[model samples]
Target: MNRMNWYVVYTKPKWEKKVAEKLNEIGIECYCPIITQIKQWSDRKKKVEIPLFNSYVFVKLPDMDRNSVFQVSGVVRYLFWLGKAAIVRNEEITAIKENLSNTNISDVCILPYKKGDKIKLETGVFSSQDAVVQEVTNTHYILVLESLGCLLKIKYKKDTL
Candidate 1:
């Protein structure tokens, strides 16, 4: 028998929670990470819970049973990486759960840096190194290291710059 692994499911826009609930009703293990944020209107502000990863939910199932997710409403497809279904390790899921449940964690806002902006690396081996922003995608920042004449691509989370 195949062991279960976590895979990301792409859902219809604004349907993460609905998809998760439907999947669970069918006995599939699913996780939808949520975050509470205060939204302000012209007159009043209200707290809302939103999915941390937009249009995405994590499902735990064996590789052979991956197609079962399509039975749930709003499920579009599985997230693909390098032409195959992307598998998220158990450790990553645990980390996300722990981080979301931690009360001390604060909302992190990513700085809006444009192409050609100069920035310094803060956490990696190239700490203190200067690099120019080549491209900024939704999930990654492509940087050109001037001194080393190389390119570095960094995948970032909501909490990191």
Candidate 2:
């Protein structure tokens, strides 16, 4: 039997929790990458945890039995590249664990953001709109927008936008 390495699984939109629960119940080794986010809503604002990527999840499985692993619900497929099982580098996995680690995590927690990426706030009045992250702070973020020739800086809760 081929030894298992980590493989990426594509899950349906917003089905990560269900997939994870089913996998764990069946004793499958699976991982869902998540991060804490600053959430904003109409009534109130709060910090909430959410998945970094919406439709992608990871599973530790051997290449040969990939078919058997695919039978899980909400699991679309295992990622492949060059006709072989694509490997998620150890550092990538480590980065995830390090982000999720509660011990000493406060010092390390960040938005997992990249420069020049469009993000939508999943909740709040700003939800469903595209905004550029100007700067990130512990509990809030400096959001920016360009309308014609003006720069707007608004302090938005970390998870809001």
Top model number, lDDT: 1
Colliding pairs, model 2: 38-159, 39-159
Where model 1 places Cα greater than 4 Å from the true spot, the runs are 108-161
RMSD of each: 8.8, 11.5
Query: CA shift at 63, candidate 1, in angstroms?
Result: 0.7
Writing each residue's lDDT as its tens digit, candidate 1 over 12-68 gives 999999999999999999999888778999999999999877788999999999999
lDDT of each: 0.73, 0.58
Candidates in order, TM-scores: namely 0.68, 0.59
What 10-residue stretch in candidate 1 is worst by lDDT?
A: 105-114
Write out the backbone clash pairs for model 1.
Answer: none
